[model samples]
Target chain A: MKSLLKKKCHRAGLIVVFAIAVFLGPAHGYAKAETAEAKSECITCHTDVKKLIRLGWKIEKTRPKPGKSAETAGKG
Target chain B: MEPYEKIYVKPSFLKTNHGKIGCEVCHNGDTKDPDWQTAHKGIIKDPTFPDADKTCGECHEDITSTAKNSLHYTLAPFGGVIKARANKKDKRVFEKVCQAKEKHCSACHSSCGQCHVSRPDYVAGGFLAGHLFQEKPCMDTTCASCHGGRVYAEFTGANDEYPADVHHDKEEMTCMDCHTGKEMHADATGVASRFDLPERPRCEKCHPDVVSKKPKTSSHAIHRNKVACQVCHAVANKNCFNCHAGTDKKGLPYFKSNETRMLFKIGLNPNKTKDRPYNYVVLRHPPADPRLFDFYIKDGLSDFNKLPTWKLDTPHNIQRITPQNKTCNNCHGNVSLFLQKNDVTDWEQKANAGVVVPQAKIPKPLKEISPKWKP
Candidate 1:
């Protein structure tokens, strides 16, 4: 009788665990799937929106002033 | 930014979950080919438009299905008003009228991107913050872009001499505060008109005790049962009298109209029901003619009396204390502000039926005031 009761309790525990897994498992998986699918190569180069502006400004910084020519830039 | 520069300056769709997919998934341009012409061939400008299933529906299936049936997309309310006025039982003729209007009037639809990412197409949408996906829609920028050209102007005091709505001016309440996403994505139940929707927002829903809280005078207690909140609160608003639509020489559709009158008037309710069973409600002349699309349809909207031309309008410009609230004479004695036989023309008398107050129904003045009215 004791052994039979222990077996029944074990079965009930398993059923409860399985039910929780069945209910909560997909929701967790779905959230992960959402994030995983969101990663892309577009972020690699275009992560920063100010890339174009920064590039233009950087080039201007490197370029010689209006009065100074490319040859005379470093000397000046 | 300059109009031409908007394309390049717009940022890539990188931050959003949508960035996970390759550009080719939504845009049909050839990114592999080196040649500009060949690569750019058949590029789809708006992919999530008309049918959001290809893009937004992949994730937001629950919302997209119902959103498709939403009045904002289906424009069934606009169609309902038009159909009611049409009085045409012939399914064939009604279908033709709907098709013709779809070409012209149906251009103002809110697509997925129009709300979630950029401005509406009507306002010449460019990317909001360089193609960044917006989690929260900006009321001033996004919602007002399309609606602002009229309602927002009145609500926010953008129009000259018009005071802002108390809800906006005092509470600083935005549209999103009252209009929720659940209401916006009203499950695809295929409601014919917005007025028919059970979940349509009402003032009493929020302020349940407004009527219980008695005012200083008996006017509120007396008229509270018969008058709508807008009739007492809303100030004079712009009403476009007549709108004549036609295609230009270049085939682009254009709408020209008669003068817009700024006036306040009380009229009979067009759509009277248990919910709005009031005898007197605020009136507005919507710029819809039975012959609006006659240019396209041979005899479009020939029967106009099917729906009242003077519609029961809920103007956005509401105030706690209006000119009408100051004295009983302001409203009770005023005939010019009442929708009567004299207000409508002979031709429009039929279309304005159920909207004009009969002489017998007009409220009699309690006292006579001196003629010192301001223009």
Candidate 2:
């Protein structure tokens, strides 16, 4: 019983750590995603997406292609 | 001299006189330093200074007199129609039409640098040094600012419709030609103290030729007769149509009689048609002779009944009755017929031949008409 209680307490500690990471870690990440979307809209005409990203715009993921790509095939 | 001897002698004298008094009593060290000669050169024994009025009014007492009589001081200082317009929300726009500065008497009456120092372009630097008599820009741009086109054209001779002999052009007169400090104030108040009337020489300054050739007795004669020069030669009305063509009450053009216009052009007003106090003589008519009476009819007995007729001489054009010379009784018949008609009075019969012919002795009047008569 003592071993089981100790195991349950360890699992609870992992869940709390996971919840804190999900809540705090993605706060800036979500802002970065929103910024990237806004930047993409600006870069369609500008063609200098890298300069905007260096100027504090966080670009995360681009639109995926329908055809096979190395990164998409790896994800699959 | 030895140093001890000089110091002892001066120190003894200073100790005897000044040791009893404070150091500054003799030296004035507290109030002013004796060694500061350059800074204390103009230091006064008494430190009191007169007020601004006493300092300025000493030299500018005459300015006070001039300002009292000046139009700018008398008329402008008190608020009037022009001042009311100047202090408005749209002051900049209103300044384009009326002068905003001239509304106050203090603007002109104050010391020179008060108004003129900033406007160096208008008044030269002498104004800042309190020289009020220096030339100013009043007649030029300053007057033109508010007076605008009217005064500008007058001074520049843009409106030269006046006759060639007009005084304005002859004298090269500016806006100050007729108006001065005194006369301008005369408009508001009934009385003014200053009068600077220009003499005849001022007019002769431009009209030298007219003045030299002027009759010696002209002025005296005019004065004796109480006649003004404007009576004969003056602009009756500025607009030609006003006098010649007539105008409505508002000075609008209207039709006028040609006869009336012609008479007015000759210095006669047709409306006032009373005869002038002058003389007119008529010559007498020439004598009527018998030769000119060819159209007369004769009525009498026998050949005497022929109408009396006359023939006219070509050159002299004299009219005479009867052929050349015939006796008196050749046409005369009974005397009663001459008395019956009584056409010719005694005076007429006497004056006929330059002789007093008696009425009863004259020939009888013609009775029956005859076709053989000359008439």
Candidate 3:
């Protein structure tokens, strides 16, 4: 019980610090940087779809049952 | 998902109009650092949530303003039902229950980005298509991701015992074909249930001729206003049992439910109206129980009997030849097919009293019948 309470407190502390950081004002970044090109390095590392699927990024191709016991479907 | 999939951005997205806005504007994160956590210190994970009046709202003001109240975004109807059953007299306990509702139930609610850009957070969100803004969210991927447990699964005939809905099998009609963009993006000002919406999807909306004065079939003439279409057409509909909610050791919430499939039941119409004048309707037991909020506050829903347990349902497994349509005797004399008084326990007996069909109320079998309704 004490350990669970401590973990909750630790999470609460992090949330408070994060909230303060947000209130302090915008940090140094390209929030309003204008360029001829969008210049997104985000796509640099995130475009590999096949790897994501292999790593369990569920992109269900077919309609699969939500659970095991749900049945082949009803007596339709 | 791998860390990359959670943050996957398509190269093609960067070329689109939305992508041209740059991630910094929407995310409000640092571009100087490459460290994922450090750079995303103050990131707005979903800029189009709660209300998108600032980011995407700059471009699409009208939709962003109204979509906030959409059932997909708010899921407020769930709360409405809870509130109806709750003992609002105890303000302190009621307030605590509301927080529990937010922690567990509302955790699965959606936003624009979750639909068009990525999977829902509850499903361990990842980009849907390299962050490319889709005009229509994929039926299987986006819609089914949330509704997979019931509607999407039953409609497409994922249930091995039942064939697919006639519309899905014959006409290849998808959810968007009937649901429409207008209803989904509608202004839900004072709506508690989907049926409360003025422009909800109706079977009559598409099949007008079947409801004509001089109907082609005798079955339609007899049961048109008296019975719901699902009473005759729906296959074994899925019915869920007691669902309980609790927080794990890590303080994240989850739900556990017991359900049964291929069970078709008929009961008194819970919510009848001019649009749906059916006296008898299909009833599906939603996985809601009094102990659902016990994890937060014991017996929070003190007045649980305020609403019926077996609520009205429009099951998706519509077929041309349902067991009920086999003959009049298939439904009339089959007391087992109806939701009887003994189906529910004594505690739930009060909650489901209106829906449970009495032994005397079950219809008697006729001598002859025909499968006349083909439309």
- Name the candidate that leads on DockQ: 3
- After superposition, the stretches of candidate 3 with alpha carbons farther than 4 Å from their true spots are A1-40, A43-76, B259-261, B369-375
Docking class of 2: incorrect
Candidate 1 vs 2: which has more DockQ: 1
Worst 10 residues of 2 chain A by lDDT: A67-76
Q: Docking category for candidate 1?
A: incorrect
Q: Residues B225-254, candidate 1, lDDT per residue (tens digit)?
A: 588888888998777756656666655666
Higher-lDDT candidate of 1 and 2: 1
For each candidate, the DockQ is 0.01, 0.00, 0.08
Error of 1 at B196 (Å): 3.0
Cα lDDT of model 3 by residue, B30-67, tens digit: 76565545766888888888777887678877887877
True contacts kept of each: 0.00, 0.00, 0.18
Which one wins on TM-score?
3
Clashing pairs in 3: A72-B159, A72-B160, A73-B159, A73-B160
**All candidates' TM-scores?**
0.76, 0.24, 0.82
Q: Write the per-residue lDDT of candidate 2 for residues A1-76, one digit (tens) a residue.
A: 9999999999999999999998988896988955653332221222333443433222223422232222211000
**Cα error, candidate 3, residue B20 (Å):** 1.4
Best by lDDT: 3
Model 3: per-residue Cα lDDT over A1-76, one tens digit each: 9999999999999999999878754642334442323344344335555654543334343433243222222211
